[model samples]
Target: MPSIWSPESDTHITAQYSQKTLDQKVRNKSALQKECGWPVEAKRAMVCLPLGMTEALGGQVFRSMLPGLFTQSMELLILGKGSKEYGTLFTELQKEHGHRIAILPASEASVHKILAASDIALFLANVESSPEVRACLSYGVIPVAPECDTLENYDPVQERGTGFLYAPAKNPEQTAWSAFAALARALETFKFPFDWKTIQRQCMESTK
Candidate 1:
């Protein structure tokens, strides 16, 4: 059985969340760190993602991002119970990057906390933006995602510095490569001349 039930292929279950609710739920940064067991002030960038088998968000594309993630020393906080296939991959990743990878099941408090503590939140598939995007913006976490035609409302990476965007391609390999490149670029933003705080403020502005 899937973690979430969906009647339609593109259904966004629990994707509706008010900014006020997000703010209230994730108000205390210290509490968020405690709940998620992530260092609120870690030097390494923390990336949180909510993905599932139903979304076709796991497999090769996901595996491709691992190398880049490990190279950057980015701590990944994954939300969603893994399907059997992803579970095996997660086990392999954990063996190599035990200190950097955390696989977490979906829980309201933990989800909000993880997003609040993350420096970036990721969405790989072309489906509608997850509600976590808004939650991440509310907490000033930049979103790293692929640009898809089906996306409605605002684009987080509309400009150069607001957030990171990768060109979505027809070929899965190309798409994965693009996403990996974007992930690398996102990690680079934390280094040198770039004003991370200003970029984060811009991410919040894009959400409006």
Candidate 2:
């Protein structure tokens, strides 16, 4: 498992996995946008879906939410392959959204870069005890995940919690709504850089 390390901290660990300082994270985000051919000046939130794009993994729910989720200030980068139907769906969405949406095959080569650049890791399905979620936290990527025992819900009053969580619902529509609401809160917080950084720091620290 990947671990988060801060330069300011005296504690040390084995250097088995990659380590990043907050400054490197900022640079990586800009470099990733450039590598993807996205205009850096646009200043949009980079929302990443790194898991496989299958209905079993919330592909259908995400499809239903895409229209409302892809606001003018947000960009979607999907980094995995799955069903042909979803491949077609995302391809069509890319056509409609142009540079705002991108799909790339998930691989070891690209996973870390995507995590480093993304403002949020979006999970539409339950991800309790998921290594990917932990990896995202290690990279200081905020997660929008289902409410589960492994994660903590962000509290605005205390300015605490590592990421955002939404209540899971039996109904697909209700689940989608809950996910959307959680993401909306994240997007709103993104507007305030200081607060967002505080959350990012908390996310990185959680893995320690």
Candidate 3:
């Protein structure tokens, strides 16, 4: 069974996509066009990038990460100055692959809202007992972070078993790739009762 870890401070809640969100996904193409500015040819769906991660963790490694992750047609909505700083690395990366990624700038909460819209929140925080991870899980956003044994807590991605875990120190760029692969594996092979899916579902239900 996969286990998801929560902050010791409070019980985590499990949340479903809000009715307002469902309405938009179902009825508001024009709104999405204006808001997200997706190309008419591109799919409207996009992965969310959270604000805190964008701010705290979107360092040099993050700048180097985009081209690999967004090689496919994809977009981003970064919630801080971090995205702007992300430019230099992006520009360098564009020398190899250009104009295929979109970035929307805003505040952290907006990023959180976008993250909530996502299947999961991909982030890295060396800190253990993270409330951010707990909050995201409650909202149905699985967290993918590099695993650090020195951090002295169970791997959130492994323990909560809702997301992915990588050890960048060990895996380098392969770390992110591993997380994505882990996500695919989870979606395909996820089990319940004896798995993290049940735990995440219960967390969401209890939160309601």
Candidate 4:
């Protein structure tokens, strides 16, 4: 039987997995953004951090990187539930960044919508063979994750691989920095539409 994620499958899937044309992808993204109450605009990269929110899930590390990641050209969407303190932190950050940052409950529907609309899936926690990572790839959302057996580190020179990966660090500060650097690289690549689309396509193809 064909995998459900495969384009050949009978399952109805989002544009991210449907091998859509560029125009179709843009239209779908715009519609999803409007549905999610996000701004529908050109030249803005949508980055999503989904799943549980807690210290163990890298909530603190993500907080530390907010100043650097929340740029004018980027919009962040965070979803999940965990830790009242971390929830407050993200709520405060959302206020500070205005529409550039949004926090949403991690309902299955919301998570699926964000994954379909996002340009990048930001994973700050140390994860190996994570289902979340696979889900992002299936949705054509390029990921920035720690180096792991499950993901292939993107090779810009060769224009290959599924996503970006940084080596995990023992020190918390160093780990944050490494993750930041990897995300920075993804943001830089986002500047070039053709290259970014190539990577997105690669991500989708990987799951098949």
Best by lDDT: 2
Q: Score every model by TM-score.
A: 0.70, 0.87, 0.54, 0.86
Best by TM-score: 2
lDDT of each: 0.59, 0.75, 0.43, 0.74
Per-candidate RMSD, Å? 7.4, 4.5, 8.3, 3.2
The TM-score ranking, best first, is 2, 4, 1, 3
Task: Compose the digit string of candidate 3's lDDT tens values, residues 2-112.
Answer: 123222222221222432222222122233334544454223333444543444563534544555566443444343345555555444544543333334355443543
Q: Which clashing pairs does model 4 show?
A: none
lDDT of 2 by residue, 35-91 (tens): 767787434688888785888888767866876786637878888577888888888
lDDT of 1: 0.59
List candidate 2 segments past 4 Å from native: 1-20
Residues 1-208 of candidate 4: C-alpha lDDT, one tens digit per residue: 1122332231232553365554445554676667557778756878888665788888767767766775537887888577888888878877777567777666766666676667888887876877788777877788999888878898988998788899867776788889889988888888998888888787777776
Q: Candidate 4 — number of clashing residue pairs? A: 0
lDDT of 4 at 49: 83
Tens-digit lDDT string for candidate 1 (153-177): 2233553354577887777677778
- Residue 203 of model 4: what lDDT? 78
